[model samples]
Target: MPVPVVSVAQMRQWEQASWSAGRTEAAVIARVGACLAAWLRRHVPHNDRILILAGKGHNGDDARAALPHLQGRAVDLVEVRDPETALPDLERALARGPDWILDGLFGIGLNRPLAEPWCRLIERINQARSRIVSVDVPSGLDADTGRPWGATLRATCTLTLAAPKQGLLHPAAHTFTGRLEVIPDIGLVPCPIQSELCWTLPEDFLDWPPPRPVAAHKGTFGHLAIVAGSTGYHGAAVLAARAAQRARPGLITLITPASVYAVVASQLQAVMVHPWSAAHPLPGRYTALLFGPGLAAADLPAEIPATLARLWQEANVPIVVDASALDHVPRGPIPRDALRVLTPHPGEAARLLGTTTNEVQSNRVAAVRALSGQFGGAWIVLKGYQTLIGRQHGPIFVNPSGNPDLAQGGSGDVLAGYLAGLCAQPPLQGDPERLIRYAVWQHGAAADALSRRHPAWVVEDLVRTLGRVAPHRVASTARPATPTTPP
Candidate 1:
């Protein structure tokens, strides 16, 4: 089943539904506790002493409910109602140094700052040597923005309840939320609430570039022209071209400067190369134009902006602007309703949105949408901890795949290539929005697949692993193969 993502208000509505359906809030809490207990018993090993910090709210009730279910495992339960004496067990756990500390003090509904003893306990938990597993959310941390009040507990693993809270993906929450695990509580199944934020999975990316016809020739697979690389940054172009080539065969033609043509050509086998004089615009002769990745920062002979403007005016296809190209392009009302795909990281997004990096980070959702409007792209993918995909008119989809391992350099280049391949695929229902969603989902799915096998993933490895990432396909006779006859 697709993962359910919801905001705090939505979660409340669901909780209300659960209560109205004759299931008490305590029953829902017990269901959550049971899931936590079962997981701990299976993975956490026996004799692993657990110190659970319980608060006054339902989140604290969840901790207390899980205590009896610990069975023979040693449990130290602390009730945090006041500052000094409220967290005795938590303090003792910190002082004695337990193996794992469970934070069940607060959930996503926390709006106010943490007070005294709880704040002190959270600080000690942060400074502790033991691994912490926060239930629902880490104490002292805001579930929406991941901002910590006063002090917050840094957990090694967090078991989010029902749905993944928005805070878990926040930059400030990354260190605290080491490995996020979402668990489904059966008792909450009857809840009538719907989700506002959803974790996109491979299943959600159906009906993208429709299934290909076996009888189709190379031309059927849309052609992609890549304008990348310069004298110094050939690897970026090579990576992008190779990734795109691997994604769709025989449809990619990478155009680069004459100086590095041999270097880029030698490195790639699947993608064709066009060596143009560094002084000319890429000949208008393909389905899409992918620019950036190894594009020189130094002044080009014809000037890249003018060349891009010409391409936009002449070329009647989608154009993906990234990296250095984004740096050069002037921001204003778009020229036409071109199928433009902009791939920018946080810093780049900040520049494109005319705001500081901090402002972009503060509200990533707002920044991406605003930039998409400014650029008039059919799709925009803003890469970050929670990668966001923006369509011309639709809800923003947040990617659940990838980890801190993807934070390395050259990752964005690989993504640019992936998007190109997806854009080249014929739409399932001739809808461009579906293609954008599928492409974003597939890009993350590829990373997710790699991370499963290699937790410590690198950008080069991700680029090389593109072939292993499968596309959405359905069995049908409508696209059957046909034999070619020699005339």
Candidate 2:
């Protein structure tokens, strides 16, 4: 089963369910300790002294249980509880200067700001030279909001139990939950419980198009329409279309206004560029559609909405509404037959959900689901660091791949095209959810692969990397010759 990103409440229920399933507290604790100790044995050097700032709560118990595994190693347990009493031991631990600290003061249970002495302790840990491994979560951090209370521990690694906590996946929490590692075998099975948020994996791609048949041609893949660009934002159109081409779409038509036609048309090679004319009517031949990449006031005329409405009523093809186009997506519960995917950045998502961008970023998992409920669509990719993809009334899956290097302007455009290109394809034609998720994952993975070699890159660089990142999709078969004009 896919891993679920649980909240504090759900996590409690999960533990309760596990206990009800006949798991004793001691058994669970022993399993958790063994896992942590095994991980420590592999990573923590034998020579380094270990300091355990054990608390009295669940997190603290989780830390002390692992003490048996580190039997021979130099280990100290400072049972830190009340601010007044723990201060002396806290100072002593800092003075002793253990090389590795196991942070187990608080995890998901913490919501409010840390008290004065507790704040000082976290600050001291942050200043400490020792590398830290936090249990469950980083102390002084709100596991749900990913916001720091007063001072949050800066861990070198965080050993999260079962599935990852929702707040730990938040971009803001990255500094605190450094290099998240999931301890899967914790004597708990995550079944019979559902969470609104989930962590996406590379395996989510679900291998595509079993090495094409010899007779497979251009149309065998699929065709995608990208209604994008404006006078100032022509590059977005080119980027989206080319990125779709990387998804190995049989054909992609960049339908743009006449004013920005020359710039977009000149840049695209395999993807066809059609100068959009209000008099000519919206093209309806493609398998999938991508709208709103660089649209401005000039692009969203009365016809834009009318045409979208018309297509919504008549066409069965999946449409990927992105950027400015996200504003006009079907509101409330979407029609049963409609299959529209909205890809919006925080600002665009905020605009659609009628909330502030700060509110959306503060809890991205909620914002993505709210997008699905408020602006109904088959899927909503709330693009950001650890970009979230939400299925309407379903789990909000967070992409684990990608680095800050993809924090550029045209990245979403590339993602939209990548999704559309795959959506148009033959494999998993009716069920595009996996393909859509794959497209999102591949986009991040490509950026991750690129960031390792180059310090900086642009959206244009992604199309080329897509082939190297997943050659099975882009280079599995000989691509049909560049597409001809749409009828």
- For each candidate, give its TM-score against the true structure: 0.78, 0.75
Output the number of the TM-score-best candidate: 1
* Candidate 1 TM-score over all chains jointly: 0.78
Candidate 1 wrong stretches, greater than 4 Å = 1-7, 21-27, 34-56, 61-99, 109-113, 144-146, 164-203, 206-220, 277-285, 297-304, 328-338, 391-393, 428-434, 441-457, 467-487
Instruction: Report the C-alpha lDDT of model 1 over 1-487, residue by residue, as the tens digit.
Output: 3455666777778877777778777666766666666656655658777778777888888777776667688777778766576656556666765777778877777899876766776776677777888888887778877788777778887878777777777778887787766664436654354444455545454444446788888877677888888887888898888778656833888888777889999987668887855554454446677888888636444555677766654455777888888866655545565677788888998887778999998877778778877765446788877787775455776775566677776777887887777666543225555565666656666676777677887777787776565543211101112111101
lDDT of all predictions = 0.70, 0.75
Error of 1 at 78 (Å): 6.3
* Model number with the top lDDT: 2
